[model samples]
Target chain A: MIQLLANPQRFMDFSKWAAPIFGILAVALLGTGFTLAFAVPEGVEGSGGSGDAIRFLFFHPQLATMSMAIYAAMAASAFFGFVFRHLLADAGARAAAPLGAGFTFLALATGSLWGVKTWGTWWIWDAKLTAELVLFLLYLGYMALLAAIDDETKATRAANILAMVGVINLPIIYFSVYWWNSIHQGSSMGGNHLGPDYVAPFILNMLGFAALFCALWIVRVRAEVWRRKAGALAVQAAGKS
Target chain B: MSGLGVLFRRELALAWGRGGGPMLALPFYACVATLLPLAIGADTGPLKAIATGSSWLALALTSLLSLERLFERDFEDGALDLLALGDEPLEAVCFIKCLVQWLATGAPLALAAPIAAMALGASPGLTPLIIATALLGGLGFSFTGGIGAALSIGSRRGGVLIAVIVLPLFAPPVIFGAGAISQAAAGLDWRAGFALLGGYSLFFTALGPFFMAAACRNALS
Candidate 1:
């Protein structure tokens, strides 16, 4: 499979088709997900249980789920690049950084918005928020490192190493919430904390967001590949002149 | 002594002798350290906090400012290739070079902290801890900065590139070093903070050389 995709021509062909399909699917899923997310019976928890259960979707659980899922996808792309030596895999990882970063920024932004509503403050130095901030910076750093290096081969390998290092740091960032008294909440997605009542829309949003990420990632990767090709051609033309 | 010792001495000599690297770095560190407090106003509490941080931050910046000179000259002159193929382990050589670098840049900055500390109105008791943390933290900066320097070899805009790659990793040291002085100033137990700084230094000290050497070899190849 890796060898088949290793050929740039084949990968380009695949992306030419895959990009549009994913983009269309992303639009559909995002439309459906948002409608369902907002349309869910409001104030269902109503004056009786846990203050307001409907508002829960707008808070930590959804954002945390999106952040982790994006990172997991990035890590998977990085692993594929590392093991299979696939250029598309590496390109996929490179392309995913900015998208993942955008999602992280969204998570942080929404979390802060939610905090302002609930905690009456714009920002809190809670462990989870800080860790997520660091994760965002890690993505920015990876992207910067890729842009900084001149040689394509060198940049890919350097960025790969950074992404792998970041994956290791992600767990540390997650666990730091427990290790310290941060303003961020503890795990809400997995284990005993995630009950069935909340799991449905959360999973829907995760799938929708993950698909959105893939759509963006495919578009970005195709753009990068084209840019590189154009750059090589320009260099060759200059040499010929 | 081993080949590492010989490399260490040679690097130290190159860094410290007349017209040596430290001549430029020492003045840079002094100027920056003095200029910061002036920029931030003379208030004692903030000054003292900035004072401690500026000590390590200045060292980190100066180390970065001078980092391109680390591998660029050697790389341009083809000396790095020889070192890559040399009998001594490149990792050990890398470690020694980092030590020499810290001595040349970080050591002077550490030594100069007291003057800046006084200027910033930091209490006398915090001076020793500031210097100690600077020394250890500066060593870590040198090691990590060397890796960034090595990675950016042969690249355009190497200076900015090195800074971007290195500054994030540099955060832990700055936090711990600054935290130590702040805790001490607050009359809390600063030993734990200093120990954390020391542990950070140890972690980077062990890990940096191998990664730096690998980066160098990759660049050379």
Candidate 2:
């Protein structure tokens, strides 16, 4: 499938239709997910019952998952771009970073709100929270490197290397933070702590967020493709003049 | 092999002469140790408690001081091109550069680590462990930091960009290094943190060169 869409024109054609479909799907799923989650009465999903604050589960986890999923996808695309010399792969990697960062930020923000509701604190240096924050920093670093270089190709190449390094280091960073957290003994929200009733809406919102991400990623990649093509044409025209 | 030795020595000399040896980083380390207590209030109770951890934090930040010039100088002077075209692989050159980086800068910083920690009111008995962890952790820093330096070789914003790129990578070492010292200070088994720190440094030392070389080639290209 990647080979079929390796050509920029094919990607452009595919995304033109695919993007809208995904966007519509995202809206429909998110709409349904939110309605279902809110319909569940306060105090129904947990022992201590966070009331309406339980709705954050539908949003926060999905955004956090998307944030991580996008980084993995971005790194994979970067690897292909660096190794196979695919321009579209590079463009895809570049387009995904800001979106990933946005998702990560939302995840952190929502997680913080959830904390305030349940844990009575706005922040704690929990293992998962620290790891998410580090992931956000990684995204920022990737974007900064991409923006700092003047030459587009060099920037892409450098950022690709950084992405690869970040991916390799991600697990180590997570483990280290977890180890440190163990010594400090922070409370973590375990999977078993939540009621099974919350699973359905959570899955729905996760799917919705994934679809939304796909739509945005395609649009950004298309924009980059067009921008590069326009630049090429302008340079050619100047040479003739 | 002889070429690598020469490269190692040459990097050491360049680091010492051009970058002011460890003069820049040591003072920065001391200043951080000094300023941290002042900022947090000089109460002996709190300062004594955070002594080792804060010193580890300072070490991490101090390592960032000389990284901006790690590859940028060779790159700007056209020497990186020569190194790339040399008979030896660029990966080996990167390894040697990072090794020399540790020797010239990281080692001295490690030596200064215990002093800074002691000044911060860490127990004096923790001094040897502090220096040991700092030495190992600094190796990890130098190697991992070499990747950031190489990646930011031709970047417009060198220093801050390097910090933003590299600081997250510094987390593991800082955790392990500080954790080890704190474990020892509390008289728990410190071996686990020390072993983890060693493993982290070894892992980076083994793999960091390939990434650094790749980044350098990308910048050079």
Candidate 3:
């Protein structure tokens, strides 16, 4: 797969077919995931279980999980780009950043909304929230750096370094919940069974979200490649004159 | 000792002797520190609580604002390419340049912070801690800023570009440094925070030179 996509022409060829497939998958999975997220029953324990259990899906665990998963995908693409020097991998990294940023915004916004509902506040200086805010800033920093540099190669290198550095903050962000007396709940995905009722939708949503992320990533990568090609052609035409 | 030490001293002297560089940073820092209280209001209680952090943040921003010119002048004059290809290791040279930069920017800012702290209603006992934290934290900023400056050479709006690249990396240091000072100002045990700041300074001190040199090489190439 690496060898096949190493060539730009071959990657372009592959993307021609892959883009529509990803687009369809993304739209389908996202539609399904949101439906399940909103439409599914609140489980048997519902209003009777620990308030923690009742409020779990409102913000903390699900959105946090999605945020981390999106970053993981970006990091994975970045690793591929760095290790193999794959153009497609670079495109993948570039594409995933804005989408992952959108997820981060969702996580923060929803988390804040949940906080307001539960804690009677819109925001707090809790470690986890602060770290997520920092992650959002990192994403903005990456986008700004990419846009600032006129040279694509330089932009890529600068963005690549920023991504690598920003990824270091993720572990700190996750552990902030554990390390401090944060209002954000501990991970629900860890430890023992999630029980079939909750587990099924959780797993399905995660899978669907992951697929949706992949599809969005592929679409964005194709657009980025085409933009660069167009930019190159414009430069060439200017030189001809 | 001879080559890098000589280079180091020269860089330090050059950065210091240039009246505008170090002097310019001082007023910028002072103005920024003074403005925060006005913006946030003169409530002494909150000002006292945030004095240390506000001062450190002001210094960080001032240092960052000045960092762009750290290598830009040398690079433009073709001195950086020569230094890159010269007998002295670029990493060692970069390390020395950053040391000089910190001495010029961080050291002076540290010296000046007490005035800002006093204006912000900081207690007398907490003043030294603010200075110490600024010095240590400034070292880390200069080192990291060197890497950013090197990486951003020849880029548009290089100063802002370098800050965007460097500021996030500087977050841990800022947090620890400001926390230490804030704790001290609040009459709390700040040792742990100070220790963390020291650890970060040490870590970045060793790591930054390598990245800065690599970036300088890339820029030169």
Cα-based lDDT for every prediction: 0.72, 0.91, 0.73
Compose the digit string of candidate 2's lDDT tens values, residues A1-241. Answer: 9999999898899999999999999999999998888876565444333677777877888999999999999999999999998999999999999999999999999999888887788899998999999999999999999999999999999999999999999999999999999988855674435556667787899999999999999999999999999999999999999
Query: What's the lDDT for residue B59 in model 3?
Result: 78
Task: State the lDDT of candidate 2 residue by residue for B1-221, as single tens digits.
Answer: 58888898888888898556597888888888889988999899999899899989998898888889899999999999999999999999999999988988889988898888888898888878888999999999999999999999898999999999999888888888899888898889999999999999999999999999999999998
Q: Per-residue lDDT tens digits of candidate 3, residues A54-123?
A: 3345334556667767777777777677556677778887888898788889889877776665556888
TM-score of chain B of each: 0.91, 0.97, 0.94
Work out candidate 3's RMSD over C-alphas.
4.0
Question: Per-residue lDDT of B7-99 in model 3, one digit per residue for the tens?
Answer: 887787788785755688888987898789889998898887777778878877988976888888888999898888889898888889888
Q: What DockQ results do all the predictions give, each relative to the true complex?
A: 0.28, 0.89, 0.37
Label model 2 with its docking quality class: high
Worst 10 residues of 2 chain A by lDDT: A41-50
Docking class of 3: acceptable
Residue B149 Cα positional deviation in candidate 1, in Å, after optimal superposition: 1.4
Candidate 3 regions exceeding 4 Å error are A13-28, A41-63, A72-85, A169-196, A231-241, B185-188
Name every residue pair that clashes in candidate 2: none
Candidate 1 vs candidate 3, DockQ winner: 3
Error of 3 at A88 (Å): 2.4
Candidate 1: clashing pairs of residues: A126-A182, A126-A183, A126-A184, A127-A182
Off by over 4 Å in 2: A44-49, A190-197
